[model samples]
Target: MGNILSSHSPSPLSDANPSFHYLVPHTAYKVFINHRGKDTKQSLVSSVYHNLDNRGVKVFLDKMCLRPGQYIPQALICAIRSASVHVVILSPNYAESEWCLDELLLICRTGAPIVPVFWEIRPSDVRMENKNGVYAKAFRKHNKVGKFDSRTLEKWKEALRWVSLLQGFISEGEQGEMVEKITACVARYNEMASRQTI
Candidate 1:
């Protein structure tokens, strides 16, 4: 189910008391998986993508193979815009890639439904302040690039903070279980899409 954007902020969350919300949407490809290819390609990301495909959910991963020196952002942006909901797989190195961050920033800007699956990390660690946080470092690194506009960078940072606060499923170590949960979440999105078109 999608989280209703309330006027208020949610209370502090702890491991013992977690709130999970999947931002389900109504669109063409019931789901769009936002992931870092290097971080989760051979494992969780691949598994989740295939599982969603097997279930006949149109996925936005077709542009995985781009020719050398291609305009990468165009393809990714088009894909994100066409899709209904986004499934953001946050692996350890997710924030390092400019593409992944750009995709996420767009997804957030559109206000689409999202299912954020955290792998090998806790919800608290995804915040912007943790000194040792990989996300924080990678996010900070992106700002140093001179070409991108300052306003766009600010939106990206805001998106990061907003998405991190949304309730989502986690994979401590059980990849199998995580895949199952993600698959189920996609299924829910599909259901929602079907209803909207009716």
Candidate 2:
């Protein structure tokens, strides 16, 4: 967990829906949690998801939202599109998972308000500025393995850069404080969305 670190907001998101070919809204899940399951699912994700749920926030977390036999990609895509705000938990092993990277790419393209919580990694790591670092190392491995094409890899890099620039929380060694900040940020969006619909 971390404390709040306000960075300069990035440029306004493009109005275009880049992933429209694959994603379409199916439900009104207000918050989408994009995280590395291995790193934060049991710890930070569980904490945040429950916190939001108890506060009457409708959240789309794969573990809690997906049924036993549902198609995962389709379900996730719909959830991403339907959500009003996104909470991206960036952990050290986050970029190592192709699934997380692809999810992040989709989330970025959605143009939704994203609250990036740097769990245990720095914003520089996510921006890929640390050339020989963990985040960059994961991309290098992905490139070497031939699993993701150059274009897809580049898109992931771009998504990382985009998220790293957003005003977000940095880990200050306190999980409770970080969770409270994220919850407040998302609650504000939820309130705004509710008003817009009214």
Tens digits of lDDT, candidate 2, 78-187: 78888889999889999888778777777876777899999888999999888987899998898898865676677777778888999899988789888888898899
Give each model a TM-score. 0.76, 0.85
Residue ranges of candidate 1 with Cα displaced over 4 Å: 1-28, 62-71, 144-149
RMSD of 1: 10.8
For this target, which candidate reaches the highest lDDT against the unseen true structure?
2
lDDT (Cα, 0-100) at 64 in candidate 1? 45
Per-residue lDDT of model 1, residues 1-198, tens digit only: 123221122111101122333233223455678888877778887888889888887787644434444344454555677777789888788777656666776677566688888877766667767867887777667667554556555555666677778888888667898799888977887788678879
Task: Judge candidate 2 at residue 33 and give its lDDT.
Answer: 96
lDDT of each: 0.67, 0.80
